[model samples]
Target: MSQSNLFIVMSIIAVISSQPVRGKDCVCELQNSESAFPESKLSRVEITALECIRNISSEKMTEVDRLVLGLQHRLQQLNENVSMLEKEDNGNLYGAVSLRIIQLELAEIQDLLDKLGTTNTNNQQLSTEMADQLRDMKYTIAELENFDHTMVVLKDQENQRIKRHLKLCEEELNATSPPPTPTMGNCGLGQMVNVSGAKTYSLTVYGTSYSFGAWGRDANPVPGDENKYWLVVLSSSNVFGHFVRQYNSLSTILLGIGPTDTHISSSNPTTNTIQGPNMVMYENALYYNCYNTLNVCKFNMTTRTVTNVALPNDAGFNNKFPFAHLASAYSHTDMDFAADESGVYVIYATTSNFGNVVISKVETSTPPVLSQTWSTTLHKKTVTNTFMVCGVLYATRYLDKDTEEIFYSFDTKTNTERYDWRIHIKKLQTNIKFLNYDPRDHLLYVYSDAYILTYEIMFR
Candidate 1:
């Protein structure tokens, strides 16, 4: 054979002989999930990662299948349980969210997993072929004692091909992967309070684009007299806590997203703990509304952590069910809450017992741990939520006599007494849209898609 042809024959033999007999590293043992080598460049190590990523994808696919199976099994058992409930018991929101929301999420996950399974298998096959090709190339490069003209040209072409294939595989992997969708509620977002009586900072949360649409650090009365601010949100579905100033202008999120208390189950369940990124900071402590359970946890910013502050009022709360969600638009009858040196006051929802505008209060002063004062029925047509700015409660509630228009500020201090007199306050904004308290600025910020309005306290 010609000299060049003879070299090719020898290289092929060498490539074939180097195939492992045993005792090689098990690719599965060196898993990808251990730690990521994000900036690696070594071709062999990259190939190992490619292999490991495929395995990880396979494992995820298996998990997806398992979840799907569990969903199906749960659905069947739930049906049986439901039938028994109709016969001797009742139904609740446990399965309401499970059936409508959770099942749909499971199906979506399954679909992604199925696609990942197929893609992973294809990538695996492609990687194996590439590895074999690399082995052959190594053999071809063997015995390079001298510069051979044709062989140099062939190596250059092979290298170009390898680079192109590598790029294509990476693009494919990138294109098929899913992006994370963070579920951030308007936890401490919508409510307005001039935190710590400051005009430069706000105790607000960063909400998502789909929700409050505009997400940013809101202003609150910047902490003075050694107090702090916080932006609260639930962590990974199971955690509840707020973000606060760690040092200087830097911020850090604290609290493991755990249950409101022992009443919540160990099984991590999906939920909406806040309407927006809403949180309340007071007395060097942090309080949050588990909304549904109305569960509050007191956190110390100095210690950088929290402790469950179960008030006597919420002591009987089961934590088994979720609180009802407030709508996105303007509804006058929707009452929220705000707390100050006086007490914590909750605006009323149009519950049957509360009539229409239910203004409730819990005094922080010594005694029966926050009384449910004034559960009187609302005579109004429709009302939204409530928020307090400088001890004055602002409720966007429907006019009792005029349902067509939504009015602002059903002040507990003012509205608790005279009905006709308090409802006549000059309308803050005619078409009152979304409202939030900028505590740092002590201004009521109202926004719609088209308008951003700020109201300064003239008399508070």
Candidate 2:
């Protein structure tokens, strides 16, 4: 790679490192089978196996990419180390087996990285080249592991472990490429770099400071209410709490403050508490993830009646800490609810299943049912937040300290995902706990800390 390209890659690493606000004890734990992520409990696909394939492809690709990039960076450091050692010993380190192994690893990384840049579905040649590289790397690692003749014990042990890890990643990646059928969706060519925004004043709420986790605007015009918008905010609690605030575009005052009520009583006492910080307003009803439970709650705006509909067992929930609301560390939302022109939908990521995005169309009745379910290749963790515009699912990525980019999109109409588009938004704050795109007003609501920012979307 050119020096300029290396500089760009390093800059991206720096940005990613700074974006996540962690405690001093937090460290980047290796994401292997023995790490934080459990072995993926991918479920069998009865209708279409597209999501499964995509899950395997995307996860393996990400793992291999990260490992290869790290290898390249380490190789550079090793080269410098080798040069210094040579200087100290009058060029005696040239014949070191550890140095030779490092050289071999660097060569393999260079080849794999080159393949990664040009490999695509359309190009059979590039695809074959990548597959060959993976196989070669796997073979090379096995060879290095068997040869146990190294003078530098520490370097040999580290390099061997790294090679073994890389081999495992490469082998996993090799199994997913060149699927049985043709690729259905392709990522966009470039980043959606153009974004502009303004901080529309924050609403001053009366009473003690409450840490609100979920916030959404009911953009669809209510029959009796014209130009009147309904904003719903939920505190970070599982037992029972919520507020419905009314807003008019002309006035800055938020008039109505809730029918502050508790309808969280459930037959399953263990799952009675609400575990979600995500809620969506559809028609006149408010839909939210019923936390610590495998269900979604639909609260009637007029009647104030709440009904619960059980989600599929695979639908994951992340309500670990009781009474944990809007805490930054516990910010990973397992399930999300969204509304669009067609109707309301529930979105979630699952570990028991394929670890892909599962979206279900909600049927608004006494007890709502999922009319239809849609699956996508995109994983849930990679996305920070998701919202629908004209039935299209756009997901945001927490890219950097100063930016949050729209890196992926799913066309619900065709059940395809485009990964290439990266629409960059310059952020005033580092952490964006909640984001909701109001299609009716063409405004993106970003909630971080005590501020609520509104950004106008102008696509060219």
Measured by TM-score, the strongest candidate is 2
- For candidate 1, give the lDDT: 0.39
Clashes of 1: 55
Candidate 1 versus the native: TM-score?
Answer: 0.34
Best by lDDT: 2
lDDT of 2 by residue, 270-329 (tens): 343444456777766777766457788887767767788887776666632111223233
Predicted candidate 1 versus true structure: per-residue lDDT over 1-460, tens digit per residue: 3466667767766765676557654231211222333333345545655665665464453443444443444354346434433443225623453345345545654665576577567657866876776675465444231334347767887999999999999999878657764221122233221111111222223322212211112232234522222333233332332243321111111111111221122333223233232344455543444434543444454554444423334222222111222333332213344554344555443334433445456443222134554443444334443455544444455343222122344434334432232322223223333445544434444432222334433221
Question: Over 4 Å off in model 1, which ranges?
Answer: 1-210, 213-229, 233-278, 304-335, 340-343, 350-355, 363-368, 376-381, 389-392, 397-441, 445-454
Candidate 2 weakest ten by summed lDDT: 38-47
